[model samples]
Target: MKKYLTQFKPFLVFISTFFAAYIIVTLLYKFYLNTFETNDVDGITNVVGKNVEQLMDLFNCDIKIHKSIANSWLEVWYNKKYLVRIVEGCNAVSVIILFVAFVLAFSGKLKTTLLYIVFGILFIYILNVVRIALLVVLLFYFPQYNHFLHGTFFPLIIYGAVFILWIIWVNKFSKYAK
Candidate 1:
């Protein structure tokens, strides 16, 4: 037991520290938001969806905001259909990648590290918002195949984008499998 602990303590410490920082930061952000009556979209997403909503409105498109049943969160509606969910908030797929990058960097795990996780998170966030906006529009423009677009095509494209970003980061910065 002692030998194992001695061998793995550093790895454990690094993982724990990285996870602690990520969780604390995320929770504190959530706590701060909880103290206010402001909408989640504005507070969280920096109003990207809100801005898009206005653009859609200007086109005489049918998009609106609907209050969520659970979180009181606002959702984007188009032609009375739920267009964007969870308000202006983006999804977390890219965020997890960011976390992995950050923890590895902090722990000195990855090799050839260059661009840190902050940039990765920001890049992914912007891409996610853009993805949502595009998906919403595609739903309206190509109504007949909305399911295929949403369930398969767009996901492949957006996730593919994130994958490419990760690959670039790994090849350029992180020296994995080496």
Candidate 2:
């Protein structure tokens, strides 16, 4: 038993650190969310919606984002067509949290780790805004593919980017890297 424990010590450490970070960040986010009224959208989601609108506008696309009176989400409109809802999940905070957890688990030097995390979060946030704007435009053109685009394709794009980031961190920057 002692031999087995010794052999797996690194793995155990990684798991514990990852979960600790993930839980703490998630709980903090939940506490932030809880501060908002039931009918009001959280600040992060509101910022994401506004970023999406601005992104689309830069391309001369007709885009408008407004809070939904019927729910806590923001309504995204493209060319006066109701396209999609920008919900909390769409803000990519969860993805950022996941990324942070993994990075911490495989952490390098303090300065490197903190810098990587900051840049990684910024990249994910910007990617999410662009994703939403592109999704709105695509949905306007191909409403029939809404489920695939929203449920599968967009998720794949975001998660795939995060996965790639994780790989880069583990291979290039992590303390465990060879």
lDDT of 2 by residue, 1-101 (tens): 99999999999999999999999999999999999999999999999888888888889998889999889999987899887898898899999999999
Clashing pairs in 2: none
TM-score: which candidate is best? 2
lDDT string, candidate 1, 1-178, tens digits: 9999899986776577667766776776667667766543435544555655666677787877555656646677878777556443355443554455454634333343334565666766666666776778787668788789877887787667667766665565653323
Off by over 4 Å in 2: none
* lDDT of the structure predicted as candidate 1: 0.62
The TM-scores of all predictions, comma-separated, are: 0.59, 0.98
Worst lDDT run of 10 residues, candidate 2, spans 48-57
Clashes of 2: 0
